[model samples]
Target: MSKYIPGNQKHLTLNDRIYIENELAKGTTFKDIAAFLCKDPTTISKEVRTHRLSDWYHKGTFYNAKNFCIHRYHCQKTNACGKILLCGIKCASCPTCNQTCKDFEKERCKRLDKAPYVCNGCTKKINHCTIAHKYYYNGRAADRKYRELLISSRSGINMTKHQLHQKDQIISPLIEQGQSPYQILTNHPELDMSVRSMYTYIDKGLLTARNIDLKRQAKFKPRKCHKTQITDRSVFTHRTYSDFCSLDLSSFVEMDTVHSSRESNKTLLTLFFTKEKLFLAFLLNRCTKGAVRLTFDRLEKRLGTYEFISVFENILTDRGSEFGDPVSLETGIQGIQRSSIYYCDPMRSGQKGAIEQAHTMLRMVLPKGTSFEFLTQWDVNLIVNHINSTPREILSGRTPYEVALETLGEDILKAFQLKPIEPDKVNLTPKLIRFNH
Candidate 1:
């Protein structure tokens, strides 16, 4: 048989087994067979030993040996004799041994120690072999066994019932109290469970908390489809994302709005400075284009048009209805341009991702479904001040307030009623507002 060359180091295939059987039939040695298949000799030896099946039969039945031997009782007492005085030989190999002999035992072939362990390479006819033992390797049977083992190894969880219950007792209360798994794990270093496993436990009903209890685990509704055509494409002709990327301007602000439950009419208008990571929030009576425009007019009046132009030289925002009137937003009461406005691509809020990432901190305080009806502008200012004062690794461990203090003058900070919060006292939770009262 021709040698088979292997392409890469992989499991043996059906073709390799067929070639091994053919090589064994030709009286080929394991080392030579291994060389032909590009495998180690020991690998071939182990494969044959592992997958080979053993068969047994009595030789006396075919040989027509007499059953009435006087030594049968002595042979039956001990299948093999330890001394010559008791019995001359083992019963299975003795000529007088038959199926009727109580000491009957199948004999193992001595040839199994030589080259091949199976009958596939034996020169003697299988049916005529006097030795009662035989071994044969079947590729199909070995393949089935391999697949069964692979599946069984991966089908079950490794945790014990007691360990699972302990995890549930620790994690369940925190989840019930409106803490996320990430938050729970962060605060409790000894939990030692992964976030994915916690989620899986909740999903599988292994914990007291269900998926419905998670703030963000609720089923998402499909977004309502709208016409793709821009209502005023002319406004975005020069204000597209491509144009925004080409500009080398150092100062730019991203603007977004946060809304409460549908029953509440109050909302928050958030402004973020990309350079310093400074955040400013204003609570509005309602979310409307007129409200947004009015907020800008007030800021211009408070800081004067020149200072407003200096502070908000460029503004980037999403295509929300509140920001639909970009012309009004960019112009002051005197109809002069105090700042330039740019819109992110429709439905692509990540185009201005910095502001969106900042919202996560806001959500940590006032969770989703919270009504903002009881909140005031002072409360919003407190939240923004705390957020601004928190140190950021991206800013080289400097707080936004520290960076803004050096970059933007005290007048601008005071104009917006923003104050620096103590690093240790900074609080982002709704409790900050409650505790102040």
Candidate 2:
């Protein structure tokens, strides 16, 4: 037997129960079992008594008082008890003495009270024992019961329906106003709720809002798988995503074009600097490769080849048709290599995730299917300035305009018509455009 260590506080595990069951079957004393398990004797006693399964059987079917009483069948006691035919004396050995007899009283055993409370380590044969009430300790059954209780205890909320309605009234208006749960909690500390709880309320319809009311709660359709067909193998042979990963560069520019509608030829050419999160938007006259090339040409002419090379050292973009003429994009008008271009995998726009995320801010102001035909370059520049000026938590609460001014210099910002708005005045809705017009 192992020695018991004092002050060891841990729950009894399945292994401990199994060991107790095996030791009990071997007729080991409770003290010995406790020492082997490094637990108190009372703990073992309580465990066996608390978790044991109890059952009752018919008295005549499995129990006989003659086998337990010394008088046996030769005894001549009769009509002393109306309930059962047995000796009137309270026999401690008789199985049904306390159960059937009206005048019977139970006597406690000192051995059962001292250490082992039950018949765990009794050396007598179980079948010959006359005790009608039976108790059994099963490790697997006890473990399953414990697990069920653990799950049931954590299944529901503790708040009342009125309290939930109060929370719903506070959270619904903010959610409808397009403020995220985190933003609401940040702006109003009085609402004592977690972001996850807010989502749960929306999902359960406990509030006036639904899941669709949240901007990001709308589910995205799964991307359909299609066979890979290489129309121009040379376009991707050298400018693959693998080549982009191998380059030892700290900064890379992501470019993508946002279209208004299938019928509209006007689009916005967007470029994002990954490290600083600075966004640049140019309104294109036509959604064609020539317009994209012209935009880059204008940028190079304004920033000059040396400054342009410094800024756009590596450009990573999608395989959109507007970006098809990468050879023209990488070379200047004088036919000099100004930058390197790489293309992401097919249907894998998330490779350049920075720009894709930046488009979300644009969508807040100019939603999908809204025409950009009436929008001019100046309007696009104003929207880009507001977006770039908005502070981001990812940038340690600093706006992209501040970081760009420190890294890309004010001269480049002036050349690209990028400017910062006041932090409090930065608006990312269509109201900014409509009010100004």
Candidate 3:
């Protein structure tokens, strides 16, 4: 039906399993060619039948040999079945047939990647992953720096919060040598650090508890008072006690004003005993001269004539408008013989230490900046009575009443005394009562 075609094995040689061409060129018939080449008769029959019209075999011989040589060469360069050889069959002389060929055999089932990661068991991670590397390095370094700063900054704190005595025990050595924070930080870089961190360390209980006596180092500056001058002569030093040495005892009574607050509705002007710890406080609607004279007159009338003269000699007051007018106050002390009042130096309050000390007593009952206007006279009376009955170290641990009785003898105590306070009525103080007088 159609032209017969030769197979690809047509290029095979005798050594390459006996090609049908060799048997056919030897004058063998198609049947004999197939038998000798161990191929089917149809294979040989196809090869000869395709060139049946070609009488001359010599013309095709050269091209046929050329093609056969090319085919053999190519076949020699490859493995069996025409696949490129990694190592040829004859390994001795062929350079391309060595073990170093491109297609050399390798172990195909082995692993080729890197090792597993440290976080192998992590639920959200994969083996040999590196996702946490950046975060680990960053967080680890930050935590280290934080700890170093937190611990090292504590060296800068200098103060302690302990008692004064314990503070002396712990800090005397440092204070005795006059150590400054700058010097300390220089010597020990950990100490005397940033001010914020030092305060933080103190708040966190990292510093010693002994209180430090950090002196208010003066900043070189001029005075900052608003009032340029006060022309009150009686508010200065010794003005109130100018004639104290010349006057007899109980003749001079120190007078001073006590305020709760500057804008308080009521005021306190208390009388003082310079010799003893006796005090009398009175409340006033206003700190005016009339209010003071009236309160003093009432006190004078309340005490008997003998006792009144014994306690009231002269009134020593400041330049306050309430007590500055000698004319108004002279009428108040009318029955006293030759009573001479004295004035304190202008703005010199310490000269009237007797009344200043009485102020301290009142501070116990009415603390600093307390509102006297809100308090009753009964409260002031209770404080006065407590101070009178309270035994004081300055009076040989005796109450003011006892001191007066001791000075005047038992006859004075028994005659006009209303009631002698029981020993259990008040607590005695071992320490000296701080009296400005």
How does each model score on TM-score? 0.48, 0.48, 0.39
- Stretches of candidate 1 exceeding 4 Å from the true structure: 1-230
Better of 1 and 3 by lDDT: 1
Please write out the lDDT profile of model 2 over residues 231-256, one tens digit for every residue.
66677878999999999678989998
Clashing pairs in 2: none
**Candidate 1 lDDT, tens digit per residue, 1-437?**
22112123356767777788778777788899888777889889987888777765454333223333434434434343333465645563455455546545444566776558878778887657665556877777766776787799986567888877887887888888999999999998787888998898888887888999998888767577542334766778788877887897777999999888778978889999999999888888777777888789889989999989989999998877677667878888888899988889888889889999899888877788888999888888888888998999999999999899899988889998989888789888868877866
What TM-score does structure 1 among the candidates reach? 0.48
What are the lDDT figures for the candidates, one per model? 0.78, 0.77, 0.50
Residue-wise C-alpha lDDT for candidate 3, range 65-92, written one tens digit per residue: 2121212223343443334546455322
Q: lDDT at 137 for candidate 2?
A: 68
The global Cα lDDT (0 to 1) of model 3 is: 0.50
